[model samples]
Target: MSLQVRIMTPDRIFLNEEAEEIILPTNTGQMGVLKNHAPLITALDIGVMLIRSKNEWTPLALMGGFALVKQNQVTVLVNEAESAETIDPNEVENSFTIAKTKLEQAEGQKQKVEANFVFKRERARYQVIKQAKKM
Candidate 1:
């Protein structure tokens, strides 16, 4: 048996299919879900979500939201999502470098917070592409 996975954003449904395994980037940490997993809800973080189907892994950049796992069904609703296939690796790499520099140079608390968020987002996107290439 496989888990029904549906990932959605405000603009559209990003994915709707079956997955053998799912690795979610939750606020607490990474959570793995499989068939017959217990029902629960979790707040996601800006990170990479890895979905495995048919022995192949696909990575996606999730921009924070919520996820529900119930009866072998996983529903992910995120503020934004970017697929590895759609992202430009070169652009993401450059943005990630810039974000890291900005975060390091940030002065005030507010600047640090904003810069940190951008750094995380760009890092997530970069990781997704890297993971996809490996798999």
Candidate 2:
């Protein structure tokens, strides 16, 4: 049996399908869920979410959110998400560089906080590209 996985964003549902395994970047660390694994809920971080089905892996860059696993079903609700296949490597690298610069030049606390979020998002996208290349 496979797990019913659903990934959603604010605007709409991003993915709805079956997956052999699901990996989420939780606040504590990466958590892997399989069919009939467990019942739990956890906070997710800005990172990559990997889904494996039929020996193929798909990577998605996710922003901060939460995940719930119950009854062999996994639901991921995130603020934003992007598929690794759709990301432009050069664009991601450029955004990462720009975000780093903005973070460094951010003077006020609010600016720093916003810039940090952007930096984290870009970093996750970069990591997603790298991770997808391996698969």
Q: Point to the candidate with the largest TM-score.
A: 1
What's model 1's TM-score?
0.98
Task: Give, for candidate 1, the lowest lDDT window spanning 10 residues.
Answer: 126-135
What are the RMSD figures for all models against the true structure?
Answer: 0.6, 1.4
lDDT scores of the candidates, listed in order: 0.96, 0.93
Question: What are the per-residue Cα lDDT tens digits for candidate 1 across 48-135?
Answer: 9999999999999999999999999999999999998889988999999999999999999999999999999999999998998898
Query: Any idea what lDDT model 1 has?
Result: 0.96
Q: Per-prediction TM-score, please?
A: 0.98, 0.91
lDDT of candidate 2 over 7-125, digit per residue (tens): 99999999999999989999999999989987999999999899999999988999989999999999899999999878998899899999999999999999999999999899999
lDDT of model 2 at residue 63? 97
Model 2 pairs whose backbones collide: none
